[model samples]
Target chain A: MSEFLVLVVPMWVVFTLAAQGTILSGRTGVFNVTQEGVMALGASVGFLVSYKMGSNLVGLLIAFLVGALVGLVLAYMTTQLRLDQFVVGLALFFATTGAAGLLYRQVIGVTMTPPRVDTLPKFEIPLLGDLPLIGDALFVQDYVFYFAVILSLVMFWFLQHTSAGLDFRSVGENPKAADSLGINVTWARTWSTVVGTGLVAVGGAYIPLPFTGIYTDGMIAGRGWLVIALAFLGGWRPLYVVAGAAFFAAMDVLGQKAQVLGLGIPHQFIEMLPFVATLLVMVFALRWARQPAHLGMNYDRESRLVG
Target chain B: MSTMQKSETGPGGSPPVAKPEARGPGILTNIAWTVVPYVASVVLAFFLGGLLIQLMGYNAVDALRAVLTSSFDTSFGMVETLHKWVPIVLCAYAFAIPLATGKFNIGAEGQMLLGATGGAAVGITFSDLPMVVLLPATLVAGVLAGALWAGIAALLLVRFRVNEILSTVLLNFVSFKLIDWVATRVWPDAGAGHPATTPVGDGARLPLLGSAPAMHSGVLLVLALAIFIAVAMRFTPTGFEMRAVGDNLRASMVNGVRTSRLAGAGLVIGGGLGGLAGAIDVAGVHGRMLEGMQSNFLILGIIVGLMARGSMLALPVVAFGIAVLEYGAGTMQLVSAVPVEMVLVIEALILLLLLLSDLVRDRLRSAR
Candidate 1:
């Protein structure tokens, strides 16, 4: 159970960044569902290079850069094309899913062949690894785990206090007003969207690390949508999102623990804990979760509306 | 609210040059607006696919031939098309009905799963019952289960302003898990080494009619249901109210239409219809429940709904077309070394084109 939360914390950070991106881009009039596809694109890019170059450092770099690139394409499509966000979200879902599966199969072939990866290893702090419980869960972990914690705080500082954060929030609140003040609606959304997608990639890639090792085709397993829900539950608040992630991870862990308590229920349903919890969050938690006013709306610069 | 419509783009600086010359709402015109978008979307999608094939150094003609030849190669291929269309047609109508009233019931996946699980559970449990008793039971279970599941979202929306998309999508998670529980714990088939549920008894199955290439009496049921729904939409008081509420909530409310109740009714009816697809799938096709059974069905439902534009009559035709593509795509896969993920790529291209072309038309309408 503890093992699960430890795994989930980092996952939440990745999702938070995604949620934050939506909030940020909501300011700029873009909510891209291309996260799922972009994450897979990053996974393939990161996995193939890391596997070939046999360097974890290079793999990490590749993951971040490719994530940003996927974000850029999504930003371009939603902002430039004047397409519907819902459809964009669905298209990105299909594109990434099909592309990842196709690419993975092309490279790996029909056999249930396992692709190789020497994951960046986790090291215990000099004395921390021996502590009662906390040490094992947090101190003694992979580079990914450490990075997950740091990134969460970094996202917190970046979004809440930064000048760029103000611009993003302002953009989401009123794009026409933001545009009048020369807020560069397109550029802010583009970059934030890029960062957001990059974060999603990081979240997705974390799945195949020490937790599950080699990647499966549908390894993402709908975690992307859960993150979208989580963003809403957290109200795009950095700390609240963290709490929400913990709640999600805890429910999932509880489902597994139920069997130990001799519930004798279906194990399959038990594993479905996270998904169920996400639904609950969306249903009940959304009331408390604050959403940006201009979220999921497209802004046409050519037709200005002075409200 | 009518006054608020002073500007279509939300309280604007100008009323904008009024240029929507009444495209005299012709029978052909309404039909053209609805039907042409789908054809255009598909064509645009494949055109993009051709570009992709060219990029791959593969002849576009060969790919096109493969896609076509694959869909209609053999009797089995024809059967495959029928099989896919069964649910696609049912689910498309299921989605479109609710959407027509401006309710986004994305929970069709979850609803279908629940209805399927309920229907399958009854079928499997009473495997020994005579067909006379079992068949009705399966259909009833499916409709009731789907309605029950959809009720959750409807209740949430009417009671608490819960966004249906968020709520329905979440419910999908609940249904997915519920099905998993049934598959793994209560009814493990174990016939194949894989983790799947046991197949239902033969008595519960829906039989096919005379040599109709997998077109069972279920097709008649589908056709009957479609026509009935079309008539209901065009002439019924309930249908008119539903449409009115869908088009403008405030207007419908002020006009004394029971907006929330009507929305709830749409949810129930839509959900019941969705579950019917799953019921038919179990009774007409697969004899047992399996994990991830309705996942693809859900996607097809969404695509078909968009293509049909909320028309009950158009659902089956659009679904049949989708089935043909699936059949063709699958057959091509057997002969060619190409992976089947290409089918989804085909679908994505089609949908993307459909959406893009629609955007252009929307722009043109606004521009004029």
Candidate 2:
């Protein structure tokens, strides 16, 4: 169980960070559907940078910056040009996905064996690490795990407790009203989307660090899409998202470990658990979970429509 | 809302109202207006792609030439492009049909795979059946399976108010595993040395068109489907209602249109077409359901669908263009050592540029 928990924790960080990033932009009315592509780009960039620079930290940072650059384009098109957020996001998704592969192939070339980087080293939390199972599972981890926990808590506090966060969220709920109140709707959206997307890339970057230190195509799988579902399931709340991420991570880890678990069902069916479970959960999640009123809709201040 | 309105008003929108003073120049200019953006976008995308290829240390001119002209240079290339076009166009329909009712069906990949699995199952089970009975059964099974798969998302969207995008996308991952199980466990072909099902009987294969480099009859079927879909979406009342719901959901609801039901139907239909693409591939190309058979059709379909900009008439043409580029991508890689990913990047750039052209045209019109 402790071993399972250890696996689940890192997976949780990926979901939490990605979901939080999604909701961050989502709350600011810039619905970012580029998570899948951005995450792949992040994995590629993160893996490439770490392999070259010999530092995971640098890889993570560069991944964030690269994701931020994509976010900048998304923000410009959706906010300034007032193009459809989903359309622009989808376009960017394709561009980034292709770029991810392009960059990797250009740098690595075709080889019999892919080069690897050292996985992040786990650091024990001194006294806390001495606890039985949970400590080793949760407390004793790499800096990325700690960063994810702290980031989730900080995001929760920032979005729930701060006036700035309220202003930021108002842009998604009612951009005209937010603009009328001098909230700088565009500015709020731009920054949040940039940072939010950066965090998402950081989540992608984290994937290679926890286990395999090499990046491969389709490594993000459908986790990026699941993160979107996670954001919605959690009602775009940071703490709820953290909890939701735990469930997602558990499902993910279980799916990966199904062959070892010796479940009677075929491992393929086991692998389907995360997606099928998410579908089932979504039915119930939508009952209580309410998304930002204007989540995927572009906000036009000059438009006559009420929203 | 504005986005829907803009798409509805774009060149791909409903046919313009005939004016009493309609003349040659007016028609010519209209043709130019429609054609220029597409040409410009493609050219500009190629130029950017060339720069990227050059930077990557490849022969940009040769690569670009290979990408554009490969399909036209040889009979084999033409047949391959048409074969490729079958799935590309069908998948585009899978996407565009749903978009007509304001739902995004991103699960075409899953639907197609399920369709292929469904087709393969029918083909394998009725292996000894005459072609008259088996071929139609295989295709119908595929359509039903695809529809059933998409119906899950539709049911979730309509009954539970779950976001269709999330539901559909998640369903894709589920389909991937489902197909893997089907290939590996249910109908595993041990001799194939890959996770693939046993090949369907001869009766299930699509009839070939020519002596050498023969194209499958599925291409002809899809061509017919393209025409049927174009006419249906443009002239039929149901299509009108679907388009109305997509254009203005509240307005359609106020007018007593069964918007939700139509949206659900659109998704099922889209899924059916997606399934047809899979089934066609099974009957025509692969003869068996295999892992990774879905390829990147989902992405390509979405790209083609978006590029069509809500025009049913434009979808097949755009899909064909994409098919040419896609088929050429392999030749480009062979001739110039440029990665196949460059074409995807170029295709994406074309989509973005085409979208940007809308803004540019809008700006220019307002300035005038």
Maximum-TM-score candidate: 2
The segments of candidate 2 whose C-alpha lies over 4 angstroms from its true place after superposition are B1-25
Colliding residue pairs in candidate 2: none
* Candidate 1 chain A least-lDDT 10 residues: A20-29
| TM-score, candidate number 1 | 0.88
**Where does the lowest 10-residue lDDT sum fall in candidate 2 chain A?**
A296-305
For model 2, how does the per-residue alpha-carbon lDDT over A52-73 read when each residue is reduced to its tens digit? 9999999999999999999989
Tens digit of per-residue lDDT, candidate 1, span B99-211: 76777777787778877788898899999999999988998899899999999889888887777767777677777768877777788877746545788877778887758
For the predicted complex of model 2, DockQ is: 0.60
Docking class of 1: acceptable
Cα lDDT tens digits, model 2, B84-121, are 99888988888889988888889999999999999999
